[model samples]
Target: MRKMALVNQKGGCGKTTTAVNLASCLAGKGRKVLLIDLDPQGHAGLGLGVKPDQIEESIYEVLSGKIQIIEAIKTLEKNLDAVFSNVVLSAFEQVMAGVPEREFTLAQGLKEIEDNYDYLIIDCPPSVGLLTFNALIACDEVIIPVDSSSFSLNGLGKLLETIQIIQDKAGHELTFRILATNMDRRTNFSNRVVETLRARFPRNCFETEINTCTRLREAASAGKPIAEYDQHCAAFLDYQQLMKEILREEAKMKAKGFALKSFVEAKEKVKEPMEKEVAFIIEAPEDAGVQIAGDFNNWVPESLDLTHSHGRPVWQKAIRLSPGLYQYKYLVDGRWVSDPSNKKRADNLLGSTNSVINV
Candidate 1:
């Protein structure tokens, strides 16, 4: 099954809204979908018309191993099933701390029922914590739901950094896409933020934007996706466009291959001194000097100073490393940061992160 988790460290970025409506809209297209609410807030279930009191067995129970997944999976409607959550999920992190392979708890639970659905949509909580990690471990794609507000914009970098950390620990990288949510198309500020995002990450941002609509808010209150609540609204149309884009992207992913960060596995590596040149590029607008430090050059940051990349707002350096896995990080100006494009990463002993490259 195809899996994606709507995640953002900052709250009120429409994570739950996107999860509920996106799942519903995909199901509307006759694809069987399972909406899993990992947020303790239970907003996804509520939005899907499942009352909190009505949830006897929830995701909390399944993750904690108190019950099997089949017991928690509830049929919400035609072509759609739901695994709800409750406030009790808030304590799951502390409870699972001593458990073995804690990060894979949700993944292991979902494996049993994965074949039963075409898609599994996860609504992650607003914090950077274990629950979010569980959601990340359980899904292949990480869709960052961001509002047009500057607060949400600023938090994007931190969230990206955190994902890098999770990717390294998971021993696999995940592909991420940005979804602009709650955008007020009529407002100049909102339009500017959308423009900034498109310019900043032109290839990673989705063309479809979720607009601010009173009908969408009413649909949430009415416990339904906008498609089910009112198909004529702009919200439904926007989601329809998004669904189309997602399906197209999924088709490409299937044909091209799964994009696991660097797409290199240890066992899959064939020994050949096939030294190929690759340039690591970064957009460091105001930085005076940008350097890269990795195992290919004794981890010396000063050994590889990147030059300007063809007058673009980027710094780049080319290296000929043997076909294998390598981990590195960028020294931009004075601050060190992971290569934002390379999602595979691991934490360094120096309290920073190293971006991974498989070549």
Candidate 2:
């Protein structure tokens, strides 16, 4: 089975909505899909009209070893089955704190039902915790749903850091793709955010963007996926395109005889890097023309231009710097500005501050 998880540390990023609708769309395509509600909020189940309280068992029971994974499965449609969750799942972290291999609990549970479905979609919580770790460890692919709001972009780095930690510590290399969600095409700011995301992650972003639509909210409120609620709606079409894109990628992987398990095993044998690649990211308008100037480059303002995929607001540049203390600032539109994202700053001779970084 091909396993994928919808994960984002920020709330209201359409993580759960994507999980529900994506799973449904896959099932609608005649694929057997298992939707796992890993979030304690249980929004995934609610969106599909399955009340967590009404279910006899949930993912909590499966992960906690109170019951087998199959026992907690609730059939939602002909080809879609879901493992629900509830507020009680919030205690999972504390409950499994001292347990050995706690992070592998969910992975082990899914072993028995590996062949029962063609796809496994997990909806992770809005926090980086045990449950999120389990989902990440179990899934080979991760879909990071990012909203159009600039605030949503702030947590992307932290989430990427968490993913890197799982890969380095658990020996699991996961492929992730960013899906732009909650986009409002009518507004210039929303369009810019999407454009920036695509540029920043040229190879890691999906072409399909989920536009903001009230019908999507109505569907969730009415306890249904967009596919079932309004087949002709724009949201439904967007998700349909997403499903097709995923299937096409799957086809390409199969054509190449891709084996996720073997790939991960091979990756585990790779050596660690001696130097760290530090990324400098800043938000600015598309026309800002941002660049990084630092002591490493003799404070040359025009030495390194922050490059992005498309020109939106967000701009970033990654450079390998050896262990040392350095100070830098961004040259935006010929004006110098300290990194707003970095709190560590040093006062210069001019009385202004420069961002400090120790690598």
lDDT of 2 by residue, 1-359 (tens): 88889998888889999999999999999999999999999999899888877967989889899999989998889999999999999999999989989999999999999988889999999998999999999988889999885444447757876887786666766877899888888988787777555534445689999988889999999999999899988999999999999878666555557653343333334323555889888888766778887754435554344455565557887887656677789988889899998999865434577788877
Any runs in candidate 1 off by more than 4 Å, and if so which?
A: 253-316, 319-359
Q: Assess each prediction's global lDDT (C-alpha) against the native.
A: 0.79, 0.83
Candidate 1 residue-wise lDDT, 67-157, digit = tens? 9999999998899999999999999998988888899899899878977888889999989899999988877778988788543433776
lDDT of 2: 0.83
Error of 1 at 298 (Å): 23
- List TM-scores for all candidates, in order: 0.76, 0.74
